[model samples]
Target: MQISIIHEREVWDRFIDQSPGGTIFHKWDFLKTVEKHLGYKLLPYGFYVTDEILCAIPLFYKNIRGVKMLFSPPPQSGIPYLGFVLSRNCMNMKLSKKSQRMYEMGKVFSDEVDSLSPNYVSISLTPFITDVRPFKWNGFMIDPLYTFYFDLEQSLEDICNGFNTSKRTAVKKMDKYNMKLVESKDVKQFYNSSVDRYREQGLTFPIVSIAYLEELCQLYPCHIKVYSIMDADDNMVGGVLASEHRKVTMWIGSVKPSVKAPVNEFLFWEFIKKSKSEGYQELEMGGADVPRLCAFKSQFNPDMYVNYRIYKKDLIGSMAEWFYLNVHRKKKA
Candidate 1:
């Protein structure tokens, strides 16, 4: 097998659409928009055998303070999972053959990533690829991260039954507030609310620019939905923005720090109902790395899935990481 850089948009997108492991983040348009708005250099790689493509990994190269780093799906772009999209043909193979093919593919992908000679390489693989032994063998440091998901295939009553009593009570209390959910085109409201939430927590907001959100919403209107929660007095109390791809929805949301009502719970309940009505099979409620966030999201009783962050670094990258962790992060603290 040989690994090469693939430049054809059609070929890349075709593979992504065919791969069960693919998400909207792996799409050509989404990555291209991220590149244009976030200023990351795109370098998409494909592992092939002769003329047939076996797997593809999208990457972005960036120079931070003169240190070259490569990221899959890039950081702060609102992309959660993106490492490699394997071919669907692998599903047809026997378990042994499939493992062997994946191992070979991982080796080739690792070699191609190394060829770029970036000081640091970091990627977060999607949940579908359970085996990381191949990449681990290639010397990448792995860390486990987690996200929560709701299966929409079950009856809505059954789904809600899994929710903790607190969540159900919050939803039930929504009627007293006279809250209304309005789908809107404005992303700045959500962005500002998110910033306010971060500020209230004494943390820096880590989202991409509002202009990027606007562009993404415009670029993929059918895939992206932004909704604002309004009180009876017509004030925006909370909002959420979510994107759908292949029957799964990933969300970003915020609620007003001043409002005392359960606006977030209402917003999510409405969104989940809408998603089910629209025929989506699952709703991924993004990550739960923070304790507060995990506790809040756990009330909904979504199943947890682990995501892996794999890293490879050179000597310069090690120094950079240390500085960022000890010096820069300390200063922020």
Candidate 2:
């Protein structure tokens, strides 16, 4: 079959929407939005077609060190966990002996990525195993970073049933406090309060600035959202900002001290309920701070697994990036 490089906006999105693991992140509009707002160089994407469009890797072309390569874009440069986004369909294609046709799809895209003449291509996948293998096959390195997810496909009763006693208690306490989740477009109060809370607790936040959030909101207006919880007095008690990627929605949460409420728990349930109502199948809690984050997320009855980040550098750029990280870490320490 012939593989064609598709540059037309409509053409790329049509294939993305139908791909096996198609996700919101891989959507043409989302990618374009990100590129337009964030100004990162995205890869040159193409379609792999035999009988039909089996798969496509949304990529952008880049030249680093006199070498050209195709990769997914604009994850913070020093961050270990950033990569190109892919649809769920292309990601879940099973690699079986009889699956020559399916395998060819990845091969074609892989060839295209390698042909970009860059040192490497980076792709990001959700925490599910069923969504990871496609990139692993194409010689793109894999690093399994652990993340947490909750499936909202079950009824609230079924979800609560899977929760351990401690988590159940947290949920009950949250409910008893009369805290309620509030959805709003108010950016200033949420952003300022969250930053203040982080500092008050002597914690370091790794999130981007409010300006970035504003840019993101404008870029993918429907995909990125902010939700908050307030007490009877209408004071913000807890909040979360989330992004929708394909069938899954993940959020970051924060709480204020005056609320004396189980705001975090309330926010978690709120995001889940909202996600499910919006027809999303899963809610991601994103990566946690090891045992602590994992333990807190466990209350939601999620599938916990390590999401790996694979790294390969041609010796030179690898060392530079590593040093940059180490220097910054040392300064922080």
Q: What is the TM-score of each candidate against the true structure?
A: 0.93, 0.76
Residue 309 local lDDT, model 1: 88
- On lDDT, the leading prediction is 1
lDDT (Cα, tens digit) per residue for candidate 1, span 119-236? 9988999888778888898888899989888888988888788889988877777788899988888788879888788677666566568888888888788888788888999998
Per-candidate RMSD, Å:
2.0, 4.4
Question: Candidate 2, residue 136: CA error in Å?
Answer: 5.1
Stretches of model 1 off by over 4 angstroms after superposition: 325-333
lDDT tens digits, residue span 1-333, model 2: 356656778867776665544555666666665555445566545544444554455555555555443445444321223333334554555656315544554566567555555554455543333334555676657766666777778887787778778667787677567677776788777778876776775553444456666666676667777777878778778777777766545545454354556677777767767778988777777646456566667666687656555433566546545654677544532
lDDT of 1: 0.82
CA displacement after TM-score superposition, residue 263 of candidate 2 (Å): 1.6
